[model samples]
Target: MKYDKKEPETMDADPMRLLVSAILAFTVMLFINGFVGSMGGFPAFVAFTLVFFRIRTRAGMGNGGMQQELSDRQITGRLLWKYAAGYLVLWGILRIAFLISRVTGWGNINGASAVEYVRQMWNTSLLEKWAYFFAGMIMFAFVLSLFPLAVIREKVRWIRYALVDGAVFALVCLGNNGVCRLKFEQKSSGGATCLIDHLLLCGRMRTWQEITCLLAMVVFILVIGAFVFSYASRQYAVKNIDGIPASAGEEESRRHRMIRKIVTVGCSIAAIVIVVVIVLLMPKDTAGDYTKVAEFLTEDTRMGPMEYGDVVYVSVNEEADLEKNGIAQGYLAERGERCDSRFYQLAIANLLYTDPTGKTNLVQTAGTDGGTYAPVASVETDKTWETDDVFLLWDEDWALESAYSHEPTGYVACPADLIQGLRMQFPDVTYRTADFSDYDAYFTLRGYQNMEQALEEDPVDGDWVGCILVKDNKFYFGSYENQITGICLQQLRKVLGGNAK
Candidate 1:
């Protein structure tokens, strides 16, 4: 009998291809790691492992083009030990860091004393926490670096792969941190500046602790990659012994195959159902509130010849009437002067009169003997206008450079005293102040312009002050440069409810 002989295929050991594949796999894993809680990490890791295996197979890296030439028993034993070790090391590091942070008074765990903090930490189920930590890290390592490390073991030196993998992981960490920082700054600053500028600014402002923590994280990641590579490489080197059969491409029994098929179909159906439920339960956008307010301002006959300057005259009576008018218009007017007038009126009404619970009251008072109303309220000097509910005052300047030109520019300043008084009066209400320059950011964040055009014209130089009222997590803004007088407050109070002392 003649036997046919086939030559074993030699795997392609392209360093660049391996490096790129590792980067892409890890990048995707990082992106999707926290997608659906810790469980999300498992699928991402599995996907990466599969990809790593395919890459190795195509390159003809191991026995029958597999990354590891180990028998089933050897592979299982090695994986269990590596996973256990990785989990223990990572959990220990985290626990140590937590303790150190507490001892140093940096943890700020509800202002607990060091003893209390330690007690609290120890009181929790450490085993359970460690179990979770281990699970996450084991999955992360397997998907992120373990498989890749094993594949490269035969082709490249372990030390070289460790160094290369560690460097790549460190770079990924830095890039991810930079991206997150940029996003946070954008949200805080309302996207006023470019991401590069924000990154540079934030880099300069990072505290020593922050820098240290970042460096430590990078080192930790590097160590993990190195450790995984070292352990996996050793496991792959082990020769098959008696009673330990190869696991790759082994034929399965009919029942086992049938069970596997059923499981796959079940998981697919469950995933589809979860997606459908999530879509159905998604929260409705609150942009419609701003749209409703805009519509009420434009179409309500009670708004009666409203003007940008007339926002000061808005009262509870007009407010109630305006709210009653409901969302009558479909869209806001163009962003010219007319748009500004409508915006101010709508903002004022929304701020003063939208409370459905009647917890707020507007009181009218007599005019101040001698007070001037200006378009912009000056923060250079002490000035106070008493309202029934609170005293409104502005005593200091808060300035910022222009986001567009990077030149010194003015911003609307809210008086600290006024804020304190308002807070005292209505503890539940939230107050935010914004300058004219911040209008775009403020409006965009609030989703105020459902169909309103961007304000193309430069903000009026003297018109700098604005007040934002936050109730039930909803924002309402109103602003005027004109100095508010006792008489003005009285008239506004009369419209609101009654006389102010």
Candidate 2:
């Protein structure tokens, strides 16, 4: 079609296409990065940024529907290959590892905790169904990748582009396959991809409030979409109109430039907010992921599982049953808000059948082979266990022995009676004095370095210990050998129905 001689002809901007593209990218990001947390997540984030630029440029340069045609393939190539399939494998590995760990790792010896882990891991049926649906879709997509092979000449390019995009995604997102893994050392792994992942990966879905990441993502889309809209429309105006006065064309170009500046500033602000939100909400480490450690602990290693160990992890996520699992949301107890040991310790205690409803006051005692050789204060908090929270000292004298180190009051509520009672309950499990080494050994086995190293670098936060290693019927004070966190305390507290004081 031709334009009239007097006025400049304006072409309509494809707002729908831009909007649709953003939504598609957002959904792919959530599916690939948000819930599943694969390495592809950051690349997917980068891809979304590129998608906006491509859509606008193509729309401005095209006549009719050409913009949508070629670009849509890129979407298929980018989303399905870069983000979807990558997360599919990672997410499946996590789920399968969880199941495998349950049945094989701890289940082989600690039958009691095995049941508890399985029951707690699959706590919500609805969430499990959603997870299952996600898994099924991943499988479907994987199969779809093969369907093109059946009719080789027809859709082969689609698969080819997908693979090509995937390779690009890996190289760009991982700095050519150089990931820092799940271990954090308070030092940047020193690469561009590491920084991007640090700034962009969406937070895992733990509580409902983590939806902030989604809001951040949407804002990102809208900001980019606005720029695309204005640019496309202005380009359309320049191209479709002919025989217009030079001044009018100059005026249009000038206005477009101004709009571009405004949009650029707006986009910059939005990008900053997105980065801030991402950093604030990004899953810091892979500690919540225990599937690797759990599955591998069953195998013998060079340094007895600690050598060449890869314990980096993703969150075993859920939004339900936060209370039933003794999340201790509304309960009055030790404020585990700041202490790493306290958080895991209290969480386990809250789940205990005995201490689930009890007021707890037991001390963490150790004689030697632990750390600094000094004992922490006795447990004088409102936390409990099935039988006890954490047990270390076994001898009555050691349990009763006065300790000079502790918090605030400097006096510990020595649980001599509690130790004797616990000892009487399980007389066969030889107990040893415990310390940070137990937790240290645990983290070390999973490639965490050690307890002190973790505490120094990452501090107390999410998923301190992934899977509790089961000893072959030996109890180190209140924990076990090669134990770190008190997650193994579940073995004794499996029958808690009352207070342990």
Candidate 3:
């Protein structure tokens, strides 16, 4: 009896298909790394390993180019140990590299040490920081590529893997960095909290630019998802097909099934914990009550009667928006005669006051009344002045524009001699002077086309004003509706004496 000759096994997988699979896997891993932040490496490693196994099985490694026929327990145990060992080894290598760079300035180290370099990078532009991170990722990916390449039975060229890895690196770096930078620049403020809020789209989109950027980001994510799915499907024909078991009589062991069940439960618990932690860590805005502070300052006339000869400059804390509480409501009540209709009151509350509550009756009303308010520009000032005051008073709306412009165009209340004297005290500060006439064109350009349409429904004596006053050497800062003008003037008179005109 003669034995039939067995045909030699041949590698039939396409190189291009393998390359595409590798690229898609790496891209997805990078996304996981980015979304979960700096400590995202563990999850990314596990995800990458899982995807690698699927790709390997699809390429016909375990079942002689047909399916994965290995025992479930054997496969799971082997992959876990292999991946964990590799991850720890790579982590050690990176730590060693960090130490070496710190000691010898060998790599991208820019400061006295690696820690200092990281801190400096944090202060740099968002794009620059992401670029640095992606550079490191590329190096890590090169090492990782070898594992997947070895698992495949096909003798594919190394250059193909390298080319695919390079393409993946570029795509992830550009796509993530570009989108993050766009969102970051559109933010009104910058901080860790702001960055997180922007990423999650939790922050309010206040302008057209922010809205457009958000929409673009949504489109970008969808496009990327489509490409990843298309490429992955073409490269790995796993869909609509079942894998053959190791033997005709074989079944998954009870212990192996239990292990998988444990893993599923563990992952679910971990995900819930992460969500709870993130919610707890989120920042909350607190509306400061400055009414007591204001009253305390006003009652302490112990500084003695302010003299016109003694410069009395005043400034309010510009960072906190005026809270819409008793102080705000009281101020509004005094100006009730000027704000004849509810519409004007709503506009004043929404536009002129900064309520940290985020929602107020006035804001809700304004939203329904078809009225819009101009966004206020945040102005920074020196906080060292002793006489800083916080009260609400409305002056011409153009006063803010004039002050920010830094042009000497408006008639400031303090005498020129007094203003010059105060200027000498703070020689480093650049002050802008503006008169009523200087604000005429500014008002028009700012959409105050019809003063009646822009302000109160009924004509008012003046628009609401919030300002910092510099008289002689003192600064008084306040915010209020039109009625606070007289009270503010009274305080000014006490400080200016006969000089207040």
Off by over 4 Å in 3: 1-17, 20-24, 39-76, 91-115, 118-501
Q: Say what the RMSD of model 3 is.
A: 20.2
lDDT tens digits, residue span 379-409, model 1:
1121222222222221112112233544423
What overall lDDT goes with each candidate model? 0.35, 0.31, 0.34
Candidate achieving higher TM-score, 1 or 3: 1
What global local distance difference test value does model 1 have?
0.35
Clashes of each: 15, 12, 27
Where does the lowest 10-residue lDDT sum fall in candidate 2?
365-374
**Root-mean-square deviation of candidate 1:** 20.6
Which 10 residues in a row give candidate 1 its minimum summed lDDT?
Answer: 363-372
lDDT of residue 486 for candidate 1 = 48
Better of 1 and 2 by TM-score: 1
Q: For candidate 2, report its TM-score.
A: 0.25
Off by more than 4 A, model 1:
1-5, 8-32, 35-54, 58-143, 148-207, 239-501
